[model samples]
Target: MIHAALAASALSLSFAAAAHADPIKIGFIGELSGPAAAVGQDMLDGFNLLLEEQGGKLGGHAIELIREDSQLKPDVARQAARSLVEKEKVPIITGVSFSNVMMAIHKYVTDHEVFLVGSNAGPSQIAGKQCSPYQFITSWQGDQAAEAVGKYAQEKGYKKVVVLAPNYQAGKDIVNGFKRYYKEPLADELYTSLKQMDFSSELSKVTAVEPDAVFAFFPGGMGIAFAKQYAQAGLSGKQPLLTTFVVDALSLPAIGDSAMGIISGGFWAPDFDNPQSRKFVKDFEAKYKRVPSNYAAQSYDAALLLDSAIAKVDGKVGDKPAFMAALKAADFKSVRGDFKFGNNHFPIQGMHIMEVVKDGQGRLNLKTIATPFKSYQDAYHGQCPLP
Candidate 1:
């Protein structure tokens, strides 16, 4: 009788251990140790914060988030994806800080049937005809922000606007998208190397042209450098500098007062007056001791998206069809209120024109000025075959 009781107790303990089981693993790959580190770190923080709020579980299943640093290199990103998929065997992988890196690892993730949810850097190819059914973007296409500022420039009657960006995929996309909407004679279009720190040459051209306005799409450290140099060159006072992804919460703190009065465009900002937005901003500030950028907000939304989909399928991430269907439904509450995925797996959302303003705390922050595209969808959606 005593032996039987001991056996029964051991069986009960073993059953309880099985019931708890191991966590559902999710992989995050991004540029966590380079010029783009801030953007990647902020996104990771946002994703972790969402999981933290849910008690480290999504869909009632414990989660194990495996993170890898791509260092903003394509080869590194590919290797990271391989390790995550093969070794960690994560069902979902998200977070790509740069379009270049995203492009590098896109095929591997999608081909493996691992759901790839982009927190940032939605390159044009992934949003168009080449879009994979397994991939979804919670962020704007690389051009949407530029398009917003471009339309604003047109409406404001900026006749000759000079455009500048890094000579890369995202840079080209920004210039193209702006031209598509601005429809203005270009004063000059400048493309610099991704690592170019000295913008004196470009600024000199802008000064010579004396365009009605100047627009740029510099991200990460490039933005900080450009904004500071623009001010030092005495151009910010004379010509309005309109930008995208260059003067947000992440860059503004680094750019300081130089970012003030700079008009920028984005889909989300710290001051967006929604309950979800407010809560996210407040919680992020309290935890991170800094204001969250749109990148962070989008990453948070991505986690929530996964949570919603996982719950819908009863945490069965293995149920690919059911999980994908749940993701398409987009049942999560986004901080950027109007969030919905277009057929192309990119967001069909509004874009806001924002101006950098000094908050009461003497910090630069984005304040919404206008909603240029109240209901905007990316132009390439028609080419996407995914429904």
Candidate 2:
């Protein structure tokens, strides 16, 4: 009887060890290559920073992060998503950097019931009537940042503004959102090819229109190219450039003095006066040797959100319904401070106006000017049917 009891106890210990060794696999798909690679790399750095801080574990469970480069192509993104979903079987996927890429794979990810925690590119469709219960965005919608700058320009009495964006879904959404709030005449609404690098011709149009202000939504390397070209054309000092996500921390370093005096709008800035924000900025700079952009902040928040939700579920990510419920709660201390999930699963947060200014060290950085919309909610919230 004693020998039998000892054998049973040993078997129980073996099962306990196996349970402890189970790994939580997380899939991260983003444009790790191509023009937008910097954006994706910043996001991955932020996400990895959080995991590193926690000793590479989440909710007291070992985590295996599977990263795939989408190469900024819809087909590539779709293929990467399939590999992560079908073969790797990650319960959660994150680090989507572009709206077009997200739109391509969102349906497949959600249909399979895998939670997609977005770090960037909150498109209107995903934030509104088409919102999936399995998808959550820590980033602002494509329009929200532009809307903030639009209101700022309107208040400044800019009568005619020239708007330029890549001819894409996000570009159109940004333009529409800006128009919705700007209520001013558009001098020109120009859409350029996504891969078009040389904006000398586009800048010529802006000079011809001679609008009161120039607003754009170029991000990543496109932003660098535009800012440099705009400055070289002597328009940086001549025309007031107001933009969204264009002259941010990520792009400012590359654009340098070209981004100076440019006004942009976003939810978080490196100079934000919150303890969490300060800590994140300081730590991120120490780790990455560069200031963190709004993209990095949002991605870091996504990781924290995952950590919180997984904890609530006690690491039982297999319990899909309960895990999603925990995620919907959004019980994380966001670096942005006043973060909450709208009914549509997008962030309902404030939008602040920022100006690119040279710091005491002569390095260009974003300085918060004003909060145009405090506790702003996206326009598509009411359209979302998710309860």
Candidate 1 segments whose C-alpha is farther than 4 A from its true place = 1-18
Off by over 4 Å in 2: 1-19
> Which residue pairs collide, candidate 1?
none
What is candidate 2's local distance difference test score?
Answer: 0.90
Instruction: At residue 285, give the lDDT of candidate 1.
Output: 93
lDDT of 2 by residue, 1-387 (tens): 999999999999998997777689999988888899989999999999889998898777778999999998999999999999999999999999989999999999999999999999889998888899999999998889888988999899999899999998899989988998899779999999887789999999999988888999898888889889999998978899988888877888788777878999889998888888888988899998988988899999999999999899988999998998999899988999978898888988999999988877788998989998989899888888987
Provide the TM-score for each candidate, comma-separated.
0.96, 0.96
TM-score for predicted model 2 compared with the true structure: 0.96
